[model samples]
Target: MNNNIKTILITGGAGFIGSNLCEHFLNKGFNVRVLDNFATGHRHNIAPFNNNHNFQLLEGDIRNLKNCHQAVEGVDYVLHQAALGSVPRSINDPITTNDVNVSGFLNMLVASRDAKVKRFVYAASSSTYGDSESLPKVEDVIGKPLSPYAITKYVNELYADIFSKTYGLETIGLRYFNVFGRKQDPTGAYAAVIPKFVIQLMKHESPVINGTGDYSRDFTYIDNVIQMNELAMTTSNQKALNTVYNTAVGDRTNLNELLNYLKEFLAEYDANIGNVEIIHGPNRAGDIPHSLASINKAKILLGYKPTHKIREGLREAVSWYWSNLK
Candidate 1:
């Protein structure tokens, strides 16, 4: 694809991951278009690109089919990232989550199909591996969903598969494993563990670890995710067109170890951060005991190579948060 002429539409482009994608593609000189309703995304995230000639922002919601259609107009590729995240949030209000994640995803898919876009790459979730006792999750192997959020993501994959077979629309689903990095929101009920812990430790507050801090996760970095998206969108391999890939670093870190890394990183800014106490609580509902991914498929198919491991990613994330959020 020609970097200067290709137009990529990123839905929810003001959100954490989406905004990073916008920045990356824009810097590469691709015509980057952003569609966001500011429901869960912030305007400040995209403020830096306001003056860029290659950047365009469309304030809209994916729940509306017209908005989706409008966003995809004249676009070459679609990076569908808009969704209501958080398993607990979905449990509390399944209807709203369904309306946005499931229905909104359908709208975007329909729009992309109508537009005849080159590829439709979307954000799937690791939560789809719910209730499965497997240690390392592979693409073809999955269990029943444990939460409404997981169900929505699984339905997205199902819908994308049907679209590919029935309408000949090329699509790829990326099952992300606990992605974290710069611009991740830390002040919300649905805040992810890494950013939340960083915020708490910065304030010298006791960071709570659910379930004895033994539960582990395959923490992926944002740069690695960007690489996966780029490869998914640009790959010419016929076998990789209509399947899912595990977008992860293929390693696990427990909450205890994660906290230790956070403290050590943050202590460079404030010595008191290393002295903060950690509290343990009961395990969260709809949360699995452990999660790891097999990235061999991605490596073989899309040439995916992770740039940062957990500790390295954590250090960079800490520096960003300290510089921006502190």
Candidate 2:
């Protein structure tokens, strides 16, 4: 094991983003501990790290205070990524979403405070932007939440702020845009757009767009998300703490453009994928028409510079899906 000062605790470490964090931190030679209940996370995601001596797993839920305490034991940094995602899922089951996203988040915050960890970094959401018609979303300016999921995420920021001021718990909230890449699950009702489209195209089925495909998003890559987390966890700038920053590519891609990119990339593996048709559907209930992030805060505060643009990220992500799912 490589010598490192920090023992990182990544909650929801079996999920796509959390699992990627585990892989990255483990590779960096930090002692890594994972806390996951396997609710939405897959065992296969963390299966590779089982053999690493520096890796430890605490099968537990953040919803339980005792489990949160146990998970934070001896951990230096808390990358709190555990939460029930999906706006539609939250819409259908607001009660469960509140239980996990809000209550569960509070439990982790309390545990991390008691444990006195160096930092508590968490996954916030761009959905917090809600009905706001801003071109590039800034952290401080947000509109009323449109869904239960957005409410939960916004509440998380409030709780984190209170924790920082009241308990002196160092915290940073990463408001992620449409983050997509390898390890993102394509199966399930609430699967993200990129992976879902990739799977559909690979199967020679027409991928459906949520609206007329004019709605846009700042489609952030997973590596950029990881970079923000690392900087948020390790940065020396005190001004960067206890606040949220947009973790995104500072660029937007409409649904039509996104579909075209997916087809263009996936067709490299299967020629017929390029010819697949796209179907349009009704706009989702909790969705906004556009989302783009202003990553200026992250750039100035944490020195964050995204390594991958939309096409670069899509090409790489498509390659991964082709290699693993094919």
Candidate 3:
């Protein structure tokens, strides 16, 4: 391992973010391995990388200690992005969410520590700011978790901090705020807003906007997420080494605004989608009203700069849906 070309492991490398991470590291001439059970992830996401010489896939579940142990061997860095996402999904079955999000995360931390990985970068969530009515959410000031999923993501940060202090393991947490981009699955019941809306409009079906359509989010693009992971992995500052960073552009887009943007953007692909009127649904349980992230720390500390805002990201996403879904 030439240090920079050292082998790294991405836990959910078959899912949208994980697969993109794998592709990114591979392009940078790194040796990458993926451990995924294909539970919520799809094999097709990694299909394009199957022929790449620097890539390997181990079909295993993270819920099993043995599998997590096997994946960590000789891994220089671990990007732990595997988790059961969705606030409503967690509310519906918190036990399963805890099993994967919390317990499974512990397993990975221990395994990575034993394997002597250089850095452990994991996915944290913006939901951890639940009910904290602060604008431009920061990393330190957080409120009570409003959902089971929020609790799990908050726990990830807590455990990562503890691991750094007691166990001498290096950790960095990226608090993703509504990430969406290419290869993000759109068929799942708990599918995220962007993909769900894109697919719905593509099919001439009305996309449901939850609530009065005023809830806003800092919709981050996958490329920006990749930038955050790469920066976190390479940061040298002592303060930046063991902390969490908000991985988003400092902006927000409301659901109704999102609907109009989607319709306008998608019309360039299919003229029919230009006219689809989205229906409003009742407010979802465990759902937060507004979400926005302040990326100043990530910029000043990690030298992290996000390339895509909501509109630019959505344009790319809409193009992907138009071609892939059709």
Clashing residue pair totals per candidate (backbone < 3 A): 0, 0, 0
Model 1 TM-score, all chains together = 0.98
lDDT of each: 0.95, 0.94, 0.92
Better of 2 and 3 by TM-score: 2
Task: Kindly list the per-residue Cα lDDT of model 2 for residues 47-137, writing each as its tens digit.
Answer: 9999999999999988899999999988899999999999999999999999999999999999999999999999999999998897889
User: How do the residues 1-326 of candidate 3 rate in per-residue lDDT, one tens digit apiece?
Assistant: 34456898999999999999998999899999999988889999999988888889999878899999999998989999999999989989999999999999999999999998999999999999998999889999899999999999999999999999999999999999999999999997889988988888888999888889998899999999999999999888888988999999889999999889999998987788888877998999878889999999999999988899999999998888778888
Off by over 4 Å in 1: 1-4
TM-score of 3: 0.98
**Model 1 poorest 10 in a row by lDDT:** 1-10
Better of 1 and 3 by lDDT: 1
As for candidate 3, its clashing pairs are none
Tens-place lDDT per residue, model 1, 17-134, is 9999999998988999999999889999999999998899999999999999999989999999999999999999999999999999999999999999989999999999998888
Error of 1 at 301 (Å): 0.3
TM-score of each: 0.98, 0.98, 0.98
Better of 1 and 2 by lDDT: 1
